[model samples]
Target chain A: MKINLKVWRQKNNKAKGELKDYKVDHVSPDMSFLEMFDVLNEDLITKGDDPIAFDHDCREGICGSCSMHINGRPHGPLAGVTTCQLHMRSFKDGDTIVVEPWRAGAFPVNKDLSVDRSAFDRIIAAGGFISVNTGNAQDANNLPIGKEAADEAFMSAACIGCGACVAACKNASAMLFVSAKVSQLSLLPQGQPEAKMRVMAMVNQMDAEGFGSCTNTGACSAECPKGIDLSNIARMNREFFSANLTGK
Target chain B: MNWISTFLKSSIGKKLLMGLTGLFLCTFLIVHLSGNLQLLKHDGGLAFNTYAVFMTTNPLIKFVSYGLYAIILFHAFWGLYLVMENKKARPVQYASYNGNANSNWSSRWMGVLGTIILAFLILHMWNFWAQYKFGTTPYTQYERNLATGKVTFSPFTGEIAGKMEKFVDTERNVEITQVKDLYAIVADGFKAWWLVIIYVISMAALSFHLVHGFSSAFQTLGVNHKKYNALIKNIGVWLFGIIIPILFAIMPIYFLLLN
Candidate 1:
């Protein structure tokens, strides 16, 4: 299959970027989207041209490293899958795939389709964790958690820190991402001690990072590669409200 | 007080403001629509005009009306400010953004729909509220027989007076009341096809706005529970979005076609 690609290219974070067209022939339908990009990059390298650069680690979906806005969606047309998991067969032969990096003031483009997502790191650093001193791994049954709470917490914990929600939101809001992080901890008994502070600090950091406010559009969860629910945001709102109300 | 200011300044706090103001506005819509439905009564503007008089003159309602006005302005301006900040968050936009793929069009285009509603609000207030308060809204004299309870109305071309005047005539067993005829103005305003068209279009925009806004307000206020979400979404999509807007639209269309 021959695939037409309009890939964004930039020299560096400060450089202006534009969509440069490239055509890759002899592409297999089973090749992953990133693998197809690798083919295109090999051709570009063979022709002594600069290859397009993007982020991808652990070609599997869990790493959340592959960040590409394929045809306006975070992970191409398919839901609940990262770009690395998106196969070429999702498109027809001669399909013009428009790939761009996450466009947010918080996530500045580094080079081509790769972006600097350290804003997420800064937010997480603010308070996205429990501060218990670790000695050794505890027995799983030592902490008694309800099945529902455990399931919900695990669901929230599935967030891989991908900036897909930010990329998908029209406002570029990080609420879903922040909320998922908040919920992952707040729902667990281990995360109960610093729950209020965690929510307040993380939310403040998210605001300071220049991300927009959530409008409850559900776009983030809809385009989320991990299917992170919007309910996490509502839970965060509840936590923030309760935390502030309690003045704790 | 300091904590209050801090909360209001935060992003979630700003969203809370939007949610509070939006839900308040939604409440006002229900009240406003319920009152406006009096215009459709067969009483020849008597019921609607009296209701309008009570709405404007009653001290408690008047106070609430003032708050309503302030809330509307705050909601509109704050929403626009948030939208500006949202735009600034994405200084560079996607070259090919298909927002429809993930979100509803109403959710994506809320600012635009809200702007349209604001413009319509200005026109509506000018046509009705301002006209009733300052401009020349003609009055009507209503005479009701005390025995038969039958009422009759005629345009009062007499001297300018207060909002309402009432007197009972013992000889004819009739009660005469003269009041400012706001309903007449409303009905007459809707007679213009262009105005009715504007109204219908504005109501359509209102419907789309409320469809997303009602449920969105709940989500922002931390009300998204599995138990109540279906109810909230239904009220958002049905009551505020479809029923209220359609009912409001029917008023202008009714006046234009039937009245």
Candidate 2:
């Protein structure tokens, strides 16, 4: 298959960016989107041109490092899948794919498609963890959490912090990401100790990080590669509301 | 003080304001629509005029009306703040943006839809609410004898003409006092095809706005439950989205076509 690619190119965060076009021929149908990018990079390197700089690791989609907006969608057109998992066959032989980075004030573009997602790290660091001291590994059944609570907690924990929710949100809100962290901790018994404090601190940090407010558009969860639910945001809202209503 | 400001300034806090205000406004819409539907009565606007007179004259309702006005302004301004903040959050635009793939069309175009509704609101208030309140138009006070069942329309030219607070409890009498005749104003307003078109278009935009906003405001306030989320969404999409807007739209069309 022959493909036309319009890839965004930028020198640095402060530099002006533009879409530069390239064509790749004889692309295999089964090749992953990143692999196809690899082919393009190889061709660019062979021609002594600057290769496209995109973040990717462990191409199996678990790392959450492969961050690129392929054809105006985060992680391409497939639902609940990463860009690294999107195969070339999703496009036709003569398709033109326009790729860009996550456009958000919090996640500034570092290079072509690599963005600085340190803001998410900072939000998590604000209160995304429990502050309990651990002596050793506890027994698995010691907690004895209900199946419903345990499953919901696990689902909330599935967020890989990919920033796709932010990328896909019209407001560029990190609510889905922040809420997932907030919900994951607030649902567990171990997390109950500082639940109120955790929600308040995390939400404050999310606002301080220059991210937009959630409008409940549900785009974040829809474009989320890991299928993180929007209910986590609602849970976080409940947590924050309760934390504020009652003293923490 | 610090906590209050902080909570109010936080993302979820701002959302809470938007949600609470939105829900309040949604309730106002249903009430407004039901009252407005009285324009369809065949009794020569008697029901609608009487209802309008009751609404504007009652003391408790007057206080609530002031709150309703404040809520409307609050909702609009707060929404503007959110929209501006979101725009700044994504200062750099995507070269080839496609917002529809991930979100509903109404969700993405809410700001636009809201702007349209705001424009319509300004025009509507100017035509009816402001004139009804402040305009020096003459009003005919209707006094009906409760036992005799005879109704009289007299030009109520006095301090009480403007503020008909005394007649708030006179439900038994068929005394028809012509206030600003808002029903005539609305019926006449719809006669102009362009004005009707504007209203129908605005209602359409409002419908789309409500479709996303009705459920979205609750979601922002974290009103999500496995059992009830679906129910709220259905009501938002069907009742507020389809029924209310369509009913509101039908008023103008009915007056235009029938009256």
Candidate 3:
């Protein structure tokens, strides 16, 4: 398929950016969206032009590194998928694709397509973990975990820390991301020691990162590559409220 | 002053304000539509004009009417102010926004939707309120009469005379008043299918605007948590999207149904 692209380009965090257009031809139907970009990059590099820069370590969708908004949508127009996994077949023969950097005040554009998601990392580090002391490997049977709790915990833990939720949200709120992490840990006994503290620190970190408050637009779950439910958000709210009041 | 501050401060505070104001506006819309519905009622010219007079002259309602004006302005300005700052507050989004982007498309376009709704509001006020306030209204039933037994008609003058009938309520029979030619005005302007069509489209625009505004308002006010957020969002979509549209749509449909 023939394609036209309008992509956002910038040098670094402080640079002003604008959309630059490009044309690509002979895109194979089977090419993964990232592979087509690889073809585009090769052409740019061979011609002595700076290649389009985007973040992608793993071509598989799990890494959440293929950070590019195609046609005003994150990860292109497809749902429940990542950019790395998107195929050229989804687009038309001669479509004009408007590729943009992820927009939200917190996630600044690092270059073309690649954004500085260190804010997410900072929020995670703020309280995403359960603190435990060194000890011998404990028996798995020691903690009496119920099936429902274990399943819920696993689901929450499935979040890949991608900022897709924030990008999709009208308010650019990280509540879904922050809450999912909190719910994942708080559901289990191992996380009990730091449960309240984790939610408090993480939510504060989220706010400190200058993300907007959640407006429940539900855009986060819609854009989530992992299908993380907004239920995780509700649980996070419960956790945060309890944490603030109980001081436990 | 304190009430405005109450709205801005806490999440609960904001939620309460959004909910109270939203529900209040909803009430006003229904009442406004009901009075307009009189055009299709059996009383002919008398029904609509009488309803219009009652709305304007009733002292209690007139006082409450002032609050209604304030609500529209407050909701409009505050929503814009928040969206503008929010745009600045989060400059960049995550690279891949999301495939699911959720159910509330209108909420995302609140700014644009609000603008359209505002334009409609101005048109709305010009049609009914301005005339009730500044322009002439029938002081007595006899003022609206046939010139002779042969039956008289006032020549439809301009858009000025067509204002009341431009967009009308569908639910009840409204008194379409005397104009340059009163019969020609109601039967021609409103009873004509084309003008009714225009009014229907405008109501639809209002509907889409409310779809997003309703849920977004609750979220803004802090209708948070796992248990209640879904309820709040669902109610928002239904009330704004479904209920309001139906109410507004009913007015045009009822009028068109009229002989």
Candidate 4:
């Protein structure tokens, strides 16, 4: 299948970007979106031009390293799948695809279809973990956590920190990502001691990163590859409210 | 004090304020719409006129009206501020953005919808509230037979009197009440085709705004749960979005075409 591409290109974060068009002929229907880009880059390199630079690590879709705003959606048109999981079969032959980096003040464009998502790292570093000792692995039943709580915590823990939520949100809000992190830890027995501090610090870090606030549009969750629920955000709001109310 | 200030400055706290103010305005809409529904009563504007007088003069409602005005201003300006900050969060927009892929147009265009509603509010207040309080609102007198419960009304074109006056005619077993005819102003205002069109269009915008705003307020306040989300969404869409706005739009249409 032949395809038309309008890909964003930038020299660096300080440089301006523009959509540069390229045509890829003889594309396979089974080729992943990133692999299709790889083929495009191969062609560009053969012509002595700069190959398009994008982020991709685990081609199997778990690393969350692949960040592409393809065809006006993060990770393309398909729901609950990363860019690496999106195949060319999703598009028609001779279709024109627009690929751009995740657009957010916190996630600056690094190059063509690549962005710096270290802001998420900073937010996580604020308080996304517990301070348990690492002497040995504890017994699975030692904690005696309820099944419902375990399931909910696992769901929140499924966030890949892909920055797709920010890309999808009109406000570029990181509430989904932040709330996922807050929920994953706050729902666990090990996460109860510093719950107040964790919520406050992580939220403060998120605000300091200059991300927009949540307007409850549900766009982020709709575009989320992991199907991260918006209820995590509501949970975070409850946590923050109770934390502040207790003056902790 | 310091923590409170810091909390309010945070993103979630800002949204909490938006939600609180938004839900308050939602309640005000219910009250305003219910009261305005009196416009459809076929009592020669007597019932509506009496309601207008009561709404303006009742002391508790008067105080609540002040609070309502303050809340509206805060909601509008604070919402504008949030929109501006949201714009700043993304300095460069995507060259090709199809927000409809992930979210509804109503959710994405809330700021624009809200601005339209604000503009409509100004026009609405000027047309009815200002005219009722200080403008040349006419007066009408209604006489009712105490025994039969039959009532009749006519224009009271005599000298200026208080907002309302009541007297009993024992000989004829009738009661008389005179009131400022604010309903006449409303009926006349809706008589203009352009005004009715604007009213209907503004209510359309209000419907879209509330469809997102209602359940969104609940989510912001941490009320989102699997068991209750569907119920909340249904009420938001049907009650606030469809019913209230349609009922409101019908008023102008009813006055223009039916009354």
Candidate 5:
């Protein structure tokens, strides 16, 4: 198959970037989207041209690192899948695919399609943790978490910190991402000690990092490579409200 | 009010504000809608006007009414600040970004719909509040005692309206109702097609704002657990998307169609 790629290129965060078009032939329909890009990179190296740079660590959709606004969506026109997991079969021969970095105030381009997602890291560092002492794991009977509570905790824990949620948000909000982190940690006994302060601190860090407020568009879930639900956001709200109301 | 406190600028802080204010506004909608419901009655209903005047005149009621204004200003301004910051941070714009309008119109047009609602609010006050506060209603000659030559006003004829039910309800734990000529003002204002058209647009804008506002409010407040998040959105659709339009549409529809 032959395909046209318009890729975003930037030398660094401070540099101005634009889309440069490249044409590829002999692309396999069965190839992963990233693999097709690998073919392009090979051609770039052979021709002494700088290859397109995008983020992808674990190609398995769990890591949100393969974050990009592919063809106007968080992950290329496909729903509920990440860029790395996408296949060339979704498109036809001679198709023109546009690729760009996640465009948000909190996320800036680091190279080509790779944006600095350290803002999310900063938010996590600001709070997203349990204050439990490091040791052999506590006895499971120390805390009898109900099945419902345990399930909810696991569900919230599913957030991959991928910038896909932010890319997917209409307001460029990190709320779904932040809320998931808060909800997951806040639900468990290990996270109970500093739950209030943790939620507050992480949320403060998220805002300070310049992420927009979540306006509940739920695009984050739809575009999510992992099907993280929007309910984590609501739980975060309940948690945050309780935190503010009573240290009692 | 620590200027740089994490609570004030924190993401959760912002969400709390959004949630608290969103909840307040939601309550206000019920009140406003209920008042409008009275418009379904004949002569566009005196029950609505009697309540408006009672609210503005009563001391405690007036205090709460002022609080409602403050909430509106805070929500609008804070939202603007966040939106402007987001604009500065974004790098690329899509050729066609309508990928997510399916969720809610309010979510999509936060700024535009909010502005429309604000404009409608200003016009509403100017047309109704100003008249009730300062303008003189014509004192009417009523059915009177012929022998005594004294006036006896008729309630149904719009000569002398009774107090709103809420004000007089023993179950209500308040001193006064804001109801007054505001109800009459509301009725007379909607009687004008142009004014009714503006009112309808504003209601539509409110619905749009609400659709997104309701959902966004939850997200901001950190309501992102998978089990309950969809519930909030579903409720948002029913509340903002369906109910609000019904309430707003009913008034204009009644005036235009029935009147």
Candidate 6:
């Protein structure tokens, strides 16, 4: 199959970017989206053209590094999956795919289709974990958590920090990303000690990062590759309200 | 003192303010719609005129009216601020854009819907609320007996034969209810087809605004419960979005055609 690509190109973070056109031929229907791009990159390199730049790791969708806004969606056309997981078959022959980076003040363009997501890292560092004493690992059965609570915690923990939620949001809000981390720890007993401080600090950092507020459009969860529930955001709100009310 | 500034400055806090003011407005919509719906009553506007007078003159409601005005202004300005900030967040535009795949049309275009509703509100207030509050209105008085609960009014009688002060009901006794002819104002306004059309279109815009804004406010405030979240979302879509707007639309139509 033949595909026409309109991809964003920039020299670096300081440079202005524009959509540059390219054509790729003889693509396999079974090729992953990134693999299809790899073929195009190979063609560009051989022709002595500056190769396009994008971020990817583990091309299997787990790394959360393959960030691209394809056809105005984060992670391509498919829902509940990452761009790396999106296959070429999702597009038809002669389709002109538009590719761009995650556009947000918080996530500045590092190059073509790659933005600095270290904002997420700083938010996590603010208060994303428990500060329990270091010791040998405990048995999985030692905690004896209820099934429902354990399952919810595990589900919240599924977020891979992809920043797709921010990219997909009209407001470019990072509430989904922050909520996932806040929900994951707040649901478990081990995550209880620092629950109050965790929400306050994380939310403060998220605000400091200049990310937009969550309007509960559900687009973040709908586009989330791991299907991270929007309930996590609600949980974060509950945590923040109580913490501030009690002066925690 | 520090917490107040932090809450005001923080993104979530700003959203919380939006939610609180939004819910307050939702409550106002229900009450306002209920009062307005009384225009359809066939009692020669007696019931509606009475209710309108009560709403306008009650001391408590008057105080609450001031708060209501403040909240409406706050909600509008705060929402504008958020929209401007979101626009600044994305400096570049997509070459080819299609957002319908992941989100609903109303969710994506809330800012537009809100602006339309705001425009409609200004026109509506100028036509109805401002006229009611400050404009000269036609008024009439009825005669009543304090002891017998008997009331009397006549289109023929220009003035009462007896002193109206003697019939005053200080403690649950019968008395005349002096009210503005607001019913006539509304009934007269609906006679215009263009005004009716504009009202119907505005109600439609309001419906779309409530569709996303209702549940979104709750979510912004973190009022989520596992079991009740779905129910809250459904109410936001169905009750506030569809039912209330339809009920409001019925008023002008009823006045124009039936009344």
Those runs of model 2 whose alpha carbons end farther than 4 Å from true positions after fitting are B136-180
Tens digit of per-residue lDDT, candidate 2, span A1-248: 99999999999989999999999997999999999999999999999999999999999988899999988889999998999999999999999999999999999889999999999888888889887666997788988899999998999999999999999998999999999999888889989988999899888888888999898788899999989998999989998989988955
Provide i-RMS per model in Å. 0.6, 0.8, 5.2, 0.6, 3.3, 1.4
**Tens digit of per-residue lDDT, candidate 4, span B194-235:** 999998999999999999999999999999898999999999
True contacts kept of each: 0.78, 0.86, 0.41, 0.79, 0.61, 0.68
Model 2, docking class: high
Model 4: CA > 4 A from native: none
Of the pair 3 and 5, which is ahead by DockQ?
Answer: 5
lDDT of each: 0.93, 0.87, 0.70, 0.93, 0.73, 0.85
Model 4 chain B lDDT-worst window of ten: B157-166
TM of chain B, each: 0.97, 0.86, 0.65, 0.97, 0.74, 0.86
* Model 6 clashing residue pairs (backbone): A81-A225
Chain B TM for prediction 1: 0.97
**Candidate 1 regions with alpha-carbon error over 4 angstroms:** none
lDDT of 5 at B89: 51
Tens-digit lDDT string for candidate 5 (B109-171): 677787787778788778866787777543222232334434333333233453332232234
Work out the iRMS of candidate 3.
5.2
lDDT of 4 by residue, A94-127 (tens): 9999999999999988887889999999999999
The DockQ ranking, best first, is 4, 1, 2, 6, 5, 3
Question: What local lDDT does model 1 show for residue A27?
Answer: 97
Of the two candidates 1 and 2, the one with more favorable DockQ, higher being better, is: 1
Tell me the tens digit of each residue's lDDT in model 3 across A116-189: 89999998899888776688978889989999999989988878877888777777778888878888889999
- What lDDT tens digits, residue by residue, belong to model 3 across residues B1-259? 5534532443323334555586678778768767666665544455565456566668898899999999988877766666775676566543334333465565566578777777778865675566556655433221222332122223333444332442222443322243322322344345657656766777777787766666555444334556776786576567667776777666656667764
lDDT of 5 by residue, A4-75 (tens): 988888899888888888899999999989989899999999999988888888898887778767677877
Cα lDDT, model 5, residue A230: 72
